[model samples]
Target: MEERPNNDTTISTDEINVLLGKLKFSEEESVQIMSTNDGKNVKGFESWAVGKIMATEHPNREAMYRVFKSLWYTKEEVDFVALKEGAVIVKFGCLEDRSRILKLMPWLFDKCLFSMVPFVKGKNIASYEFGLSPFWLRVYNIPIELMDRQLVVAVGNAIGELVAIDWKDRNGAWTEFMRLKVKIDISKPLRRIVKLVSRYGGETIEVIKYERLPDFCYMCGLIGHTFKNCKDNREGAGINDSNAQYGSWMRAPFVNPNQERNMRRNGVEIVKTTITANEDKEESQTNSRDESGQSAQKGNEKEVKKARYRHHLWKKEVISLYMTAWDGLSIRGSA
Candidate 1:
């Protein structure tokens, strides 16, 4: 009978280090350096963006790309390269196409929000943050008198960066609610309601409803994941859905364009408010209600300060979550 050698073997750290020490490299191959200018000359460096699909389960990369291509309908062809942790490097044929795609952000793929940011040269793609996205909000319960563009801008700024406003319909009639686009930070809880204080010391509550909102955590109010997969819920430290701070009421009803046209043809009259920029300006100048309205101004200032504070808190929370999640991932590589 022939003797067989053991197939399994283990190498200790010291043994591996000793073997590595025995290897030698030529002077020419020992050291190499590159400058930032070298990186700039790389292909697709000028027209690229980093994106992440905000979902735990990523869709088929090919299928997702096809869907995005159709949805974007850019003038030039776009390329998508999948990266670690559901991130992708998107290459556009031109800067125009890239800017257009980014402007129409918060795109939905398989019912999940896709957040993107313009690529920064020499920055690690993994370090790019995908926490902010623009959303169209339908603000309800706003007083008819305060439905002007100035008021909308003020409230929109308090919530997030104001992008644009839907002034009126084709018939020049105001909709039931104020519609404005604002960039929101998805890392923090969604703001469901905003309180406005008038110069008369009266308060009004405005209910915020998002259009085309995807699955989000009802318990924590964060977007990208449902409560079931939330860290708080996974650890059994979160509350039940019934007692959650957010609910379906936060989602706004979708308005169909065809339906709107039908309504217009059927002679349905929507409340008309012909507000011009000049009118808004005149109103502002005439009502220079000074420090007497200090209480109301202070209220708004306090809300803005609070929003800033919440943003800082969210950054800390995100850092903690990232560290905890990274620690759990099993890494395999050679030194």
Candidate 2:
């Protein structure tokens, strides 16, 4: 071949330094500034909300848009724009609509939590963090007397930020469990229990249950993924249902209190009818046996007393049913 120049020849250190030194920067080119009036360009986005759906798999943007539009029911039109990594930006038609949506925080889509925060001016949509999410926790094992605002606040703050307390019919009425609206850090493992210490130095372990809870890792107790896909579980020895710390117990059961009330009312009526029928049958038997002897009369008295005792037990059972219905009411308070 004929002599050819080596195109792959490396540049020497001194030659590179000389080439770099040839470049110059003027004072005017040192820094670039924008006008202060740039703020007005993004003023319209002040009422916007930016959020992300906390799910391992990306959510269906179109389905989510439809679901939120239907669920919000805003008087004015609302807009949704899907972004990368399950992130979404919402534009409300009016300030009222924006405020209403934020008030209903911790919304769910296909049972996955959609955590959101108010959009800030000049802030990048991806910069917003969705670490905190609001959840309604039904605290069990708390005494009736201890189900006060102070106790709820304390317990709520222990798990996360105390958003609000669901004081649904809590005016001196007993409930199966106290309901608290807490802003929890979903980045960490969900708190399964809280220990309470009385002023007398007595300790009580209270079980925490979440209402409308989404998918979570049973092995690691973290939200967003299940035990089968948990990274921590994969990195260590395998875990199964028997050895997992968290289970289905973390999710609270959904019960419609109104429906429960109606059912219990019908139950009470049925018990009343049964008691009436039993009493009528006993009276007829006693009348038939009246002419038998004094022994028969005494036996009827014993039967009457037994019937009365049974009636008393039924009344107590009716009361128990009513109480149970009220205690299982849905935690409607949100913030």
Candidate 3:
């Protein structure tokens, strides 16, 4: 065998290269790596739609700069650029940061309202356009039994069109108790008189026009984009077209055979009238009982609960009767 060198003398090329790469020097030239886009698909620039500022006029460049400087986010966290027509484009450093800001949107900043919307991809940030957005109506106080998809769809169709129906599942499975989402037409005046009639038990479901529903896109059946800007193939009719017809249908008075049934039922007045009559008869007995040193507070509380339960039962029974009467009238109208 040839004479072998000692361990210190015989250095491995791989070990030498590794040691050289780790060496740092003050005079070394910094090599900057640049990405070249050869018309190939690359990572997208994360952005959000920022508009609906409540200021009298659009915030200027200096104002926006001051606003951002006052709020959260460092220079590296986000890139805020003012777009054409008072809109804004916010590019986040990461998706998590973007999501966090979106959750905090429609925020009240500097005593002005600023609403955030979903950004459209492949569209120039400076030229993206928006229009009068469709709104969402969250209907609470819905009875558990009447929350079927079919019933929700029927009620939603009457309002405008069923963008989506969210069901609240308590046990990770479908149940009778749920909530509903119905899209309302923004162009036409609200149809506040429409009632949903249940086919199974003939119960009249009354929905109150509580508040403006959140924006849900009918195109992609998702919540984000305001109306048809989702770029999905499915397009909804404008308020002038299909929504107008639906609005008219909803506003039409339901024809009940009895004139009393067709007219608006004064459930509160009925309850009050019945309660007053009962109170008058009970007042004399109550006075005598009070004179005899009987406790009247307990009895009065019991009477109030009874009256409330009675009023609720009476309202439900009367509404059911009206719905049944209307069904016959609807069949007659169809014939």
Candidate 4:
């Protein structure tokens, strides 16, 4: 059997370095391998043979170092780690304001983005982004730049407070309800601090597994497709070309009838007034027709009563004529 090289074997610094160099040490791994007890037991590791052994699995420290140093890049390049709770952790990471995030989006795709959001839908949730966070973070498909500054601030504040409320509520409920899930919100401030230090540099994401947006089949509630394309009752159908994400295949929010009229006239108020007037006119006509029908019935009844009264009066003999005849007869008899 061939003799195995020992870790205690004495090896010259130059020989060990040569071996490490051949292994293509990353800067860090090179530092480690080189810093070992002055090449003790690193004999067989002194050259290409040594490099071949280390190359089987371990990273080439020298090679890594050369790449980083040559690029003149700093540890900041890879300093990002994922939030512990993933999306929920994102709920906690807040910015000084929300607009700050909007401004950072383009750069976020290019670099790392951090910060907390406290409130989401009245629940306290927090989130963090790996440098790899995508464009889905855009608010309503409208660039933060296009939105009113006040709205951006409001949305940010609201998101922050939302997560806070939910987190607190869940915590409270969890304490009372033993069966309630125990939550995990991992934030390694210490890790960040340590990485920020001179020792362990920041590291970029080594991997990503993506899950595409869902297809729950709702039109109006900001899901899958447009209402015109909806399979449900076609009550909310119409083309909404004016949508902010008009051509985007991701989401389709079609404008309904009233909206279409508004677009046709280029005025929302017009549609509202027209619809209002039409409804009011129809209601009034219905009320008036009912009233007129009642009045006509009453008129007919009055005419019938008058006709009957006249007939009765016509049927009555004239008492005055009889009286006249009697008086004349009396006068003749007397003569």
For 1-335, candidate 4 gives per-residue lDDT tens digits of 99887765655556777897678657776564334555433222221000011011223333332332222222222112222232212111223222222212211100112222323332322221222211111222222233343433333332221110111112332121111011111121000000111124533211111112222222342223334444553665544556422223432233343442332211011112223435665555567668776654454445444543443342222212322332233233233
Please report, as a residue range, the 10-residue window in candidate 1 with the lowest summed lDDT: 265-274
Cα misplacement distance, residue 14 of candidate 2 (Å): 31
Evaluate model 2: give its TM-score.
0.63
Q: Give, for candidate 4, the lowest lDDT window spanning 10 residues.
A: 47-56
RMSD of each: 13.9, 21.0, 23.0, 41.8
Off by over 4 Å in 3: 1-44, 48-50, 54-76, 99-113, 121-129, 132-136, 140-144, 153-194, 200-205, 209-335
Instruction: Please give the lDDT score for candidate 3.
Output: 0.45
User: 189, model 3: CA deviation in Å?
Assistant: 4.8
Better of 2 and 3 by lDDT: 2
The TM-score ranking, best first, is 1, 2, 3, 4
Pitting candidate 1 against candidate 4, the one with the higher TM-score is: 1
Name model 2 segments beyond 4 Å from true. Answer: 1-43, 169-174, 235-241, 257-335
Weakest ten-residue segment in model 2 by summed lDDT: 263-272
lDDT of candidate 2 vs native? Answer: 0.68
TM-scores of the models, in the order given: 0.65, 0.63, 0.35, 0.15
**Residue 15 Cα positional deviation in candidate 2, in Å, after optimal superposition:** 28
The residue-by-residue lDDT of candidate 3 on 1-335, one tens digit each, is 89876764545556778998998856445666676955333223544445544334343445544454334343345656765456776656655555545433333333233555566666654454333233334443456666565665666667664543333333332353233334443333444544555557664546443222223343332323334454543454453443332222222233333543333222112222334566775676588676865666466546655554554454444344434433333233233
Query: Which of the predicted structures, 2 or 4, would earn the higher TM-score when compared with the native?
Result: 2
Q: Spell out the clash pairs found in candidate 1.
A: none
